[model samples]
Target: MKAVLERKSEEALNNNSSIWRNKQFLLLIWGTSVSNLTFSIFTMALPIMIYELTRSAFAMGTMRAIEFLPNLLLAVFIGVLVDRFNRKKVLLSSVGLQMVMILTIIVLLLTSQLQLWHLYVLGFILYTSAYMFGNAYHSVLPLIVDKEQLTSANSVISFLYTFVGLIGPALAGMVLLVLNNIYGLTITAFGLLVLLLFISLLKLPFIKKEEDQKKTSMIEEMKEGWYSLIENKELWNLTIMVLLSNITSAATLSVFIFFALDVMNVIETKLGIILASTAIGGLVAATVAKKMTRWFTRGQLFIWSLAIQSLGYFLLFFSLDWYWLVAGMFCNGLSGGLMNIHYFTLRQETTPNHLLGRVAGTSSMLMKLAVPFAFFGVGALAEFIPVHFIFLGSAIGTALIIVYLIRTPVVYMR
Candidate 1:
């Protein structure tokens, strides 16, 4: 009993400590913001580039499949490396590889040698490297920041994400409208170059791996992560939440290009706006998340956020007009914003420092395993069913999860 109280005291002290004064944390967040900008723009631009070229929903799903395939395959190994090595080096190398790959793409575009296959290969590399970076970054946060401040820090991070979403996609749309694919890509390349500069200045606290840790077989390490996640009820439940959420979300959105272009008749040039609209709700939620989190239990926030977010689909899936679409997006973003803060912080708070990487990697790989299947399934199914019907299935899936959460201990966890 005394031990638990000491641990709580330590955690309270850590949380109340000022991370705002930490130079390293600030630099990390700033550098991450830059990298997020690069990826955000790239994410919005990549599908547009492919859809414009192929005009096939299968092609888009396949590209996404390629992206996540690498994430699924390499995530475990990346987790092992993060635990076994200096996280800063992993982050730097991953960011550098992505920059070089994006640069290669820019060159290909400028030389008129760009092709669909080229995007497939580069997208795979970009996403895989991103997962590597993410695994390392997530692991490193607790090392540098106070445990108590994680929610606040992550809320800020979520805001940056949505803020980029708000600006990046709209910018991509505007850029796509006025410029060509080459320009959209060149801008991405430039953003990555800036990321390289910021990453060079970034640093983190040192974490030592025990000699026995080095002696552990790679398979053993991977097995450890699986245990860490599956044995923990909270972790397992959160994993299930994202897994189900993503499957349905994937099914509904796998044919978004067709939905936007054919169903809504949105111009190719304005697709970015449609994509950016989702970020608006996220930004608002993020802005108030820290205060709001304090006002409610994490469980309450998660439940209510999911409810509010679910309400947006009526407008998101049904709205034909751009303005209504934006409104739906705002609702989507709000719940999304709440979901991210609690989800990530919950993992960081619970996972042991040494196991954070593997647990994150294994859980990510498992949860996202359902994503590609959903994408492909939605793509193929849309051929037979009207694209609009996909949302009906998605809404039903969400309600099922909500029902499970309400009936379980998950919603009552502090």
Candidate 2:
């Protein structure tokens, strides 16, 4: 009898038009926005700070690889943990841990004890917590928002994310120039503290799982999740596309700053503005995504999104001029923003709740599994070849990926 009413309630929520007023959903968006805005600043500054301290492109790429490597190693366990525990508790804990790490780093920086190795160890731990938080975050979305309201919820989140990205980097650059990396990170850490408070206030609906399913061994639970993700035709198609695209993006971006430094002679302070330009395009895309998705078929939108990313990167192969490079980033950001919102909605709408954390984690793991390798590979290759040449190769690789996806009959389109 309770299950019957629960189903009826879910159906009504799906048909309702007031998702914007969902307090829990809004809090979720606010929490992520707070973190993302600060993260953009800290991470953008981290790499540049590394470059300043060590002057090694390899070191910077290695830091990025540190951020990614956890996904490969811990994704399976993270999915299980999110599903087994109270996700809200897990999320708060993760964010809290992240804040501790950031604050510790700030302390280390001020004391002058920070070193390259310190960053490596800190990044590994910080990103591991972040990955866990991400699984819970994804799981929380479908729990709070109606299935039909996903697009609207996602659009707002996406807009907040990209709009902040558009501004955060530029702000970080100015901050870095005026005060230093340490001061900039202090501000970033403060934002995380606020985010922690917001997460605590969120009122999420409980998601129940069967007793028998709960009794399964962790390995078995992971296998169940993996199988479910791969077996879904649409999920598999989307995951495969992202996995391929991430390979080239990782490779290209690994060396992008080096190219700017070596070829374009771009100053570190001004580079923040350049990085921020991508956000402008992404922010614009988030603004229009709801309208655009309405006009286009899901499958077509997916393919077009990938094509735009490819076009954007391809142009970067020869963009020595700063404006030319900004134009390229704009296209890439626009498509990236579109695909992210659509992908979130599609996954939530399609996948079952029991498997949401697992599939989301697994897909994320698979998508990023090759990224570390690409970062390391591009970093090494840049020593022998021109960075722009590597960008060209990445462009070619992205184009090939697009062609394959276009021909393979994307099954995920709405």
Candidate 3:
């Protein structure tokens, strides 16, 4: 027992070293911040844009469905590609594709030839590329940092994402107002500028992979990833947890815009403020997650966060006033941030470094596979059921996950 304890302590020390603080990690973080900022802007703005153009909830749902479709269709293949190639190259190439796609969309929008189909096509392409890039990014994280620091490293990433999210939506709202008065060319131009800067500033130092020279076909590589996940009990359990969490989260997101616009009657400007408030709550939660994890077991953390979010969802369901809804969103955001830190860290720590990309991809694929269906279902349900009941249902789904966790052996191992 003493020997085992000592070994664990040593591993922890090694993980906390400055050697894990490489220049590559810093560059990657900066690049991610820039890219996510732009991504968040689009995430918040596009829904509003579609609503304004069509005023149809179905249209908004379809747009979301298009964005998540790639995760369902190409996730496994993307995972295989990430594992087989130079991950850095894969990352850069995916970002480059996004840059081109965004530029094209901007041009079309500026030319005033932007049809709804154009928006759908462009959004699909961008999100597809993002899914691929995200798979590579998450997979490579374990390679960059030591195993013990996985939690800390994930916390850092989540904190950055939360920070960007906080500013991105609010900025998008302001930009929308500014661009609405202009020729619309200015918004496109500014978006192009942000994309260029993000791509240009992205610099990754070379690092050797464990399977650097191993030649494997994509099909074989994909099979290996699948085998790994299926064989690993911990990984399989974690994947299940992720899938349940994602379903609830996606449902909430699918209906959130309608709630803000139709239910709360919030205009564009105040809507931005509310978005910022939620993001700020996430940022605050992420900032303290590391400390929280020190006191709680991973299982405990997961259960508590889910419970908090479930409660928040219930509040949202009952909230009639704008301020009350915003408060509920804020609570949900905090739970989201905490969950992000825990989920990513758990995945990184449990998976082997060589299979990180494939595992990450496979796991992402599973979680996201349900997203399109969730969006469609929620959208359709909203047409029939009251929006409040949808929120209540999401909360119930989240609660079910907690109950499953309590009964399963998933928590004790990690």
**Worst ten-residue run, lDDT, model 2?**
1-10
Better candidate by lDDT, 2 or 3: 2
Residue pairs clashing, model 1: 15-148, 282-333
Residue 1, candidate 1: alpha-carbon lDDT: 30
User: How accurate locally, in lDDT, is each candidate?
Assistant: 0.77, 0.80, 0.74
User: Number of clashing pairs, model 3?
Assistant: 0
Q: TM-score for all predictions?
A: 0.83, 0.84, 0.80
What is the lDDT, from 0 to 100, of the residue 265 in candidate 2? 85
lDDT of 1 by residue, 78-125 (tens): 898888777888888888888888888778878878789999998888
What global local distance difference test value does model 2 have? 0.80
Query: Candidate 3 lDDT, tens digit per residue, 1-414?
Result: 344435544644654565344555666677677666656556666777678678999999889678767877888888877767777777777777776776676676567676788779888888877787888788777655656666777778888887876677667667666765133324433543554455455443344454456776788888888888878776677678778888888788888878889887889877777767678778878778878867888778888888988988898898877777777788788888887788788777776656777887787788777777787788898898888788899899999998988877667754
Return model 1's CA RMSD, one decimal: 4.3
Off by over 4 Å in 3: 1-21, 38-61, 106-122, 176-216, 256-274, 318-323, 382-386
Q: After superposition, how far is residue 80 of candidate 2 from its true place, in Å?
A: 1.1
- What tens digits encode model 2's per-residue C-alpha lDDT throughout 71-117? 89899889888878888999999999888888888888889888888
lDDT computed for candidate 3: 0.74
Identify the candidate with maximal lDDT. Answer: 2
